[model samples]
Target: MKPDEIVVGVDAAWRRSGALDWGLHEARLRRRPLRAVHVVDESLRSDDFAPIRLDGQVVRPSPIPRNDRRLVDELEEYLAGADPALDLAADLMIGAPGHRLAERSASAGLTVVGRRGIGGFARLLIGSTSESAAVHGDGPVVVVPNGWQPAKHASAPIVVGVDDHDQNDAALEFAFEMAAVHHVPLWLVHAWEVPAPYTWNAPVANGMREQWEQAARQWLDTVAEQWHQKHPDVDLRHELRQSHPVVALLDAADATGTQLIVVGGRRHRLPGLMIGSVARGVLHHATVPIAVVHEHRATEPNPGQ
Candidate 1:
């Protein structure tokens, strides 16, 4: 666990171009070295490894030798051909891919992985892996979805989902820093929804809606003022919505062609709100990359679930 490194957990899949590029971009901006991680589950032998639909390269059958150097060679060879400018080296870990990567992310400044689909551990990072890393990792996890390409000087905005919670405010800081680094616009979102018990059968009053909206807007404005002073160079936009955080964020990202979505997740469970609520939903469907910042909390997810 190197403190100065950014980890990019990868598979033999070809869609890795996006995640790799993203990791490189962040590493360059953060001025950190990149550690390309590939975890192997001992149970799956070369005989068990097979080609999948998304992977462009046909994976060779796993060899009898379970040597780290062998995989490191493969990782380096692939990286050498892909992009030599990235200051990246490779590491081979023996364990469950998701679990190992989550632990690695705890010390990494950021961990980048593709939004993988369900399958064997060969891909290493499935949707579940990304979600787990985002929720449990001590740092931020960026899940790059398929078809997402990294732009060096992105003009598109970076969206941050902020709430009254301390964790959400942390996400705003990340969004501002990323936007400033890439010279892009920054969008802040604060979404509120009526409690199910309140909205289930009862008709909401116009006055109630107005009061809630006004209070939310005021809160957002106050929060934004502090960040604005800190990051005056970043083009900032803020919105308050009476919709689910997931819907408001995704819709905003799609409308603005946002480059990245930054959300906060508490390592410990918290009351009132959930840590992965908006982050998980967006990761499953977002076309853009999502950065889930891991913040610590003293609580847990909703007990009802």
Candidate 2:
């Protein structure tokens, strides 16, 4: 699907620093509509209650319902102010927040949620409903950190992690389009390890060491040069080292100010059955946001093309 047709899912809570601006910024770049969603979980309604003993002995203490509609109204107002021309809708649901958000993501091209949501500061530090959405949502999920302001014009570049063992053309193309639309740089990074000789064996296999380094450098050059032809305007950089892909990516994020790290996710149905090593490493340790493109559909574009 084209970026213009993308449905951006916005999980807005009543906060002023909501994800509406962030989501709208993306929509503006892609020329897509935004769906602002507010989930009012019954579980969060109230917990304070009193048992009735004798007749009229004790009155029940009922906690007030969370003002879900107010949050939705506030979100609509924010959306209206953020982008007056784009198509937008606000949905309020009474169910499990995570499940509702995931279901809403079914048709969306991407989902955006605040790193710290309405509940307050503690939620940001720990695992949040947003994090759950990111891990399980069908489409690409963008987790906006606290104090994140949507640029009137998006500036952060699209960065994709390229693995020698995996098919990355799909992700690279995705990043390319995003970068092109946002008018930002595109960085292609490949991180590989140098073979280390086993202890009690040779301290250094001099011949093998030289060959390994040469192969790593050549791989980076070839991939960068090949993508450069298609994305000539994109500012590209390459990093090849003995460290792990996860570590290398985090380091690169700091050095280059990467906004998103697009990587390919495993396509297997069963859990823990077919997770790739590089993806697994990235899932656990990458510092920046991730875009995991799955490989099940034939219509999905190839990254090289």
Clashes of each: 5, 2
Residue 156 miss distance in model 1 (angstroms): 1.3
Candidate achieving the largest TM-score: 1
Q: Which candidate is the best by lDDT?
A: 1
The lDDT of each candidate is 0.73, 0.64
TM-score of each: 0.80, 0.75
Clashes of 2: 2
Cα lDDT tens digits for candidate 1, 253-301: 8888888999886634543233555676776667778888875332334
Please write out the lDDT profile of model 2 over residues 98-170, one tens digit for every residue.
6677566656677766655656465234235665555555556565555556563256666778877767776
